[model samples]
Target: MTNTPSNAAREESLDLASIPPLESIPPQLGSPGGSLPAPTVDAGWNTRTKALEVLAILALAYTLFFARAVLLPFTLAVVLALLFRPVVRYLRKRWRVPEYAGAAGALVGTIAMLIVALSLLALPAEDFVRGLPEKLDAASVKLNQEKLFKSFVSMQKKLNGAGDLGVSTETPAPPRREGEDDEEPEGDDPDYAALGAAGPGAAAEVRQAGGVEVEEEDEPATMVVEERPPSLLNRVFSSAPEALGGFALAFVFLYFLLAEGDAILNNTIALLPTMAEKREAVGLTRAAEKGVSRYLMLVSAINAALGVCIGIAMWLVGLPNPVLWGVMAGMLNFIPYVGAFIGAGVVFLVAYLEPDFGLLDAAMAPLCYMCINLLEGNFLTPAVLGKSISLNPLMVLLSLAFWGWIWGPTGAVLAVPLLSMTKIVCDDVESLRPLALLLGPRIEKDDSASDSPDAESEKPAATAAPAVAPAA
Candidate 1:
């Protein structure tokens, strides 16, 4: 027992020596006295990179805003080149056709079609646009002459008591005493007319009170807020020269870009050093070209479907200029969300122009939109596009808005292609690969199905031609 006490005292002294002081010990990361070393952090690169990125983005945004006037067509040309690159490649590789020949075919094809279309439609469109003022004037006149305006006048007539505006206008509403039922007869009603005119007693009491201005609140709230579309006839006529010049330049630029696409891509890529990087870049370029081309083809098919359906729908609806409107709708649909509204506006206006159907057909505008959009979104888009251009919906819409804002309608048309190109480039770079994953179609691994017997079973059997022995 004496030895045990001595041993315990020794252990205690040893513990005290090892522990040193409580303040010296780190907070336990795992167990008491157990802790990890502070982790190494690389904040310098991230901070500098973020600052640089912000600066670059701001600079680019301003540049785009300022240069939008010139850059719009050029940007569109570049996107079109990307989209058509695969077709150029395919013709060269498969048919042994010259690249220039292929590009010329595509460029000519696109321009010829657009020119023909625009020519056919322009006169009617101009006629309609020129007449907008007259149409609106007629509408305003009809509105001013409507019974509703007369009703407002009649209601206002009540406030003046007797013949204030001259003639036997409607009598003023009699004031109701407290606890008087609204259902009571006029003879039994209080004299609110006397209250307004020279009066005493209850009329005098009414004179002591304030007069209320009762507005005729029967008009539709939306009609009250609606504004007329600005007349663009003068602006259209004034800007025609500049517009035509731009159109001419656009055609030339498109042809030049398409014809020189391969050369441009090669020259750019060839400038890179002869290393692994050059090879990787070549692959990425090829992939990006393929992606953009597929998107273009898919969009074209979708547009064709849109044109057909809209034409049929309009024709059935007995609307005038069905074919022209259909073509316009399909062409405009390229502008994303704005396209839908534009198409709807055209349909609504045409419907509203028909005297018998004006209001009735105008009411069908929303329904028409639903049908067309449904056909395009549900049936046409998925079946044709599938997982091809796997763009995030939010990103797609935002990109549409961004490009649209920067370059107007043309910019909106360029938005998706630009976004797809961005995604492709991001996916190619190792540092930005995570963003690619975020932007790319959500891909699923096929490890299980890849090895499954059913997958093999689905493969078609090879047909064997008659075989002769070599000895013969």
Candidate 2:
């Protein structure tokens, strides 16, 4: 057979004589004839490295999800105990109140207050619930009558264009008129009587006006259920037993934490084996517990004051269900931004529903929210929480979202203390020192905005205050 050297000779340097043998390559290539390119420390563009990190993070999250779901209620209780424990301690140490007695008293007081608040919510809620069906009918009619519903009309048009879902596009013929149905009983039906009682001309007019004719058996399928309780109430009552169990668990846990808080902390720390480290850990735990308790107590007072202020404002505006709106604002104020928006939404909805008020009242809802929230954010919280526990807005929002995801509304409400305790723990842990910075607030220094006069002063003329020679 003839060896095919012709194609190899035609290609670029495609010849065995032109290629260096592996053993003849340079030292870098494990030979004498060639060298390898310098290797780079690729820190950024490593796909394998990134994939590993992503997988690890996902695995950790999945593991945490199960752990959190199981222990979320306990975690919630731990945060609350931290918040309320100091009060129990103070009562015990100063007033000589028994720990168990203090816990019982606090628990009863809290529950009684919550029940009274919820009881007050019953009436307005019922009224709102009853009026919903009517409002829905009015709103539906409004879609046909008003230009404001043009947007919905467009949406409906789009929906229709997406192929029929059962509703016929062609105009449906009128149902078999009364008396046309031979199966109908020869008895009085108010609908048939009302439709048939009219004179021939009036009947024609009614038909033209779309009243049409009705069969004796044609009763409305749409039921107006006025007696039904609000879904929120129904849900609450349905879940009451399970909720009570959780509440009872939390209450019991809180009592134990209060009764043996210091002992527990000391014992845990004592197991550390080193006196200095144990002392430090014990001090840190006490500080965190005390701070959390103080914050909760102060927030309660502030929120109550805010609730009263909001209630009075609503009453002045003649808004129905003023108490609900007030309580809503007060309760939500605990969750940073989340509460403020909820309060605003309630006010807006109330104003929208009240026949006496219109768009103007609805607009005032946001303004009212802004004014109250401005006072709370700029004046109230800053003045109250002070520099000691001041979390920046970004950190607060993230904490709220994180804890809310971990638990629920209760988590959102308890986020601050949870995050605060976490921060305290992070501060104590040398390895997690950087994490404390990430979790905490940003410290912005405004040189020009300082309270000092010299910092505020503009640069003087070049002739004045020439640079002084240092130690001439």
Candidate 3:
């Protein structure tokens, strides 16, 4: 059959009509026919939204900083409650004791122990502080006697002499009278000219013959004005009232938290809309509580052991005030990385200051401290903490820096527990699991998963080749 131009035109019109409308087509397919999609406003993130998020974070930081007076005590209270919660629960379950009574007993016992420790260490610490100035002076004299110290002093003096060259300290010879003799009297033999032009470290030779005493340039007059700031003792005494108030507030909060923790948890969980959400919330809370409490308890025990070892080592090494050093070590050990170094440095200083200590004796104390610290940090801590509570070292450092900036020494002490809690929360939530993994210690990939039934089933689909169209 021969096709007419009218029939051909009709067929083309029908084919065009079969094509879908532009509005009906997906945006990804461009304008009806397949073409590159037009640029549209990004639905994921915009400048305004990101800016608001940044502002929100900054606002939060500002609030935390300014509100620390109230917040610090509350935070401490929460931590204490977490630490003692298991004990309270145990007492209630085993002995039929009320949570309130158990918490009170724990608090009282802890305070009493602290008071007893302070009482025992107070006299030694006071004596050490009182003798510190004399000890430091003795140490300084010893250091000055060393050849290295003398060399350094010599270098410094030479530098000073060089700096003073070309600068005249004496009064000029009355502008030299116009007709006066330029030369001095023969008897006097004045060598002022020689002294002035002789460069650095030159003394006047004429002074001895003339019986005129010349002050030695090497012996520069030093007026020592010791400006001592308030001591640690004075600072503590000054802040005693505030410290007491904070402690009282913390104890009160701690008591309430302990007494009502379960009720609070249950109420919060009950408010969730769905069973899955409630379960997630419950699991997150439980995990956080267990992890934080366990970490604190274990750390306290480890610190105590470290303190005991340090005390024994100090005693064996004949260091005075072993108990004081031990107590300080334990307290300082609460802060990570920096704390151990500080403790060791302080020990070295104290040991070096002692009159009986030789260089080797002085070195021994800090060496021992650092050795124990290394052992505890590298081996004992990791073993006890395990993978679940362990955090990435970088994240730990960042947390320490952030918290320390926010709340000083106390914040530094709390940094690890806070970081652990954050990691636990992230790990529990599906959306935050990736972040949790980032914060967590590195894990090896599981090759066994590839051999599993489900993975094997997925393999064919994942690796399958695409079907090719036959050539037209």
Global Cα lDDT for candidate 3: 0.83
Give the backbone clash total of model 3: 0
lDDT of every predicted structure (CA atoms): 0.72, 0.72, 0.83
Model 3 TM-score is: 0.74
Local accuracy of candidate 2 as per-residue lDDT tens digits, 1-472: 2446765556755566578755343445464554664565777779888899999988876665666534666776687777677778779989999888888877788789878977889998888778877765664554465465677788889988887667757988888876565442223765446656554566567768986555779767997777866687688899789677777777777667767766787778878978888878777776666666777778878888888888778877777777877887888888888788878887876666665555665567667766877797789877877655556578888889877776678778888767777766666677876877787742334632464566446344333446543434
Error of 1 at 152 (Å): 12
Q: TM-score of each candidate?
A: 0.63, 0.63, 0.74
Highest TM-score model number: 3
Clashes of each: 0, 8, 0
lDDT of 1 by residue, 1-472 (tens): 7799999999999998997555343445346556755766787989999999999999999999997657776776677777777777788899988877888888778789988988988887777767777777665665456586778877777766564755666898988769766441333345445334443455545446754456977976564567776556667778779767766666567777767766777888889888787888889877777767777777877887788788778777777667787787777777666678878877877766655464556658546755887778777787777754577878878888888788777678778778878887776677987887777663424734555677666543321222333435
Count clashing pairs, candidate 2: 8
Residues 35-75 of candidate 3 have per-residue lDDT tens digits of: 75455778867888999999999998898788888888899
> Which pairs clash (backbone N, Cα, C closer than 3 Å) in model 2?
24-33, 25-31, 25-32, 25-33, 26-31, 26-32, 26-33, 26-34
Residue pairs in collision within model 1? none
